[model samples]
Target: MAGDLGLWGIPVAIVGGAIRVSTPFLFVSLGEVLTERSGRINLGLEGTLVFGAMAGYGTAVLTGSAWAGVLVAALAGVVFGLVHGIICSLPKVNDIAVGIAMMLLGSGLAFYFGKPFIQPTAPDLPAIALGGWSDLPQVQAALNVNVLFLIGLALALVMAWMFRSTKVGLTLRVVGDSTDAARAMGLRPAVIRTLATAAGGAFAGVGGAYLSLYYPGSWNEAISSGQGLMAVALVIFARWNPVACFWAALLFGGAGALGPALQSVGVTKGYYLFYAAPYVLTLGVLIATSSTTRALSGAPGELSITK
Candidate 1:
């Protein structure tokens, strides 16, 4: 990053950073997509992301296995999800209010216990060398692919297919669209939503694992960088499609990497502007895609977000 690696290095750095940074966004947004699709929004995933980062790093430090840490992080998310689901399932409980409370609770618990794990070094996730044939060192570094990123990509494809073809997906859609209809069919909406929230939380947990165990490769209180919150908007921009979610995540990731990419090529002018790029891009996306006339094309009918 000292001086110029040349003009070519800018694109290389952006691509690399996009791949490296987008993993968490992809996972979290997908998780939110799952949650929102069930007509229950979990704004607390920010706290879930933080908790996962702390729990994953702490577990990795204690167990000497990154995978074990991942499992622990997922389990932690499941617990939080169960708590949210149960509370929100009660009569007159607001899902959004519960989510806010869960966020505070999850984050407070993480900050309290995560202090000891702040400085520990944990195992990093392995990456694929997709650029080995390239002579440029920048290319090789840029194309280094983490395994979790690949899994996220595959899961997006599978999710897309499942929503169109699977019985479980149809059931979720039914429950999301109308609780009364589900109850009439002898299906329990609470049970379905609870399970969906748990599964959504698991996805967010994996996103947390990627944050602490892969790209940044550390345990820190500020590891998430609002990616969890931003993911809620990302799901909206993607129209709740799993496949679209993946691409939107990459776009956000690339926007996030803009500052570092310019810096890598010896451009420091207005560096702070680059840091704010993602937020600006997010605003632009919201504006470009905004419509007050009708619900977003793919949004669930019973989703209470705007109503």
Candidate 2:
């Protein structure tokens, strides 16, 4: 297939890669949306993500079930999120600083504990063959979508709807907008934030599972490549909208896939530059969306970044 298409393969490969690459972003950004919507930011998700990858990979290697690995990873993420939320809820505690610490802690833990499993093979998630109608190998390969990506897509839609129509969503929004108001309404802002953060961690853990058990299909110290951190910017760019986050993730995924896609066609002169496309896009989106005079429209009112 690589030899079949000379120039046309780039776009095709990118589209396919976007679907594969976007799963992690989709899950992480969605999780961040939940956390940020509850008036908290979790920087430690990088650690949570890395740890999840290690846990999931290790679990799969031991259990021989990819699904089990995902479940365990989500549970691990919950623990991470719970710790971050609980610590940040204390008076005078800084969410950003704690988040940074969490990132380091998670990465350190993953590296230390993951050493043994680095060389072990784990069960990988199955893909849905959506391109059976196509004869071209490239098309077939590109269309072989993973179940996690589809689930993420559905989850995004469900979350968007949930935010609009559910009492749970209304409560989260109220808390995110104003803790004083939430307290007046007899809501426990701290408890809500902690739970939301934990739930977000579960989503992130699943994202990590996707990376290790499916797409890249391996456990490594550098598996994440900072996608966990980039998700924060992705959420901001989406204006905190779940559906928008889905699209934004795909855009990022496409940018990420560009370098490798180009290389597949023998365009390797600027390969590293191509790999930097996602970072460049992140910068561009942040700059284009930022304003010194006014808070970002649609941002949660109590979000620390806006304040």
Q: What is the C-alpha lDDT of each candidate?
A: 0.87, 0.93
Which runs in model 2 stand beyond 4 Å of their true positions?
A: none
Winner by TM-score:
2
The digit string of per-residue lDDT tens for model 1 on 59-144 reads 99999999998999999988888888889889999988888898888888989999999877898878999999987777888899
**Which pairs of residues collide in model 2?**
none
State each candidate's clash count: 0, 0
How displaced is residue 213 in candidate 2, in Å? 0.5
How well does each candidate superpose onto the true structure, as a TM-score? 0.96, 0.98
The superposed Cα distance between candidate 1 and the true structure at residue 92, in angstroms, equals 1.2
Q: Which residue pairs in model 1 clash with each other?
A: none
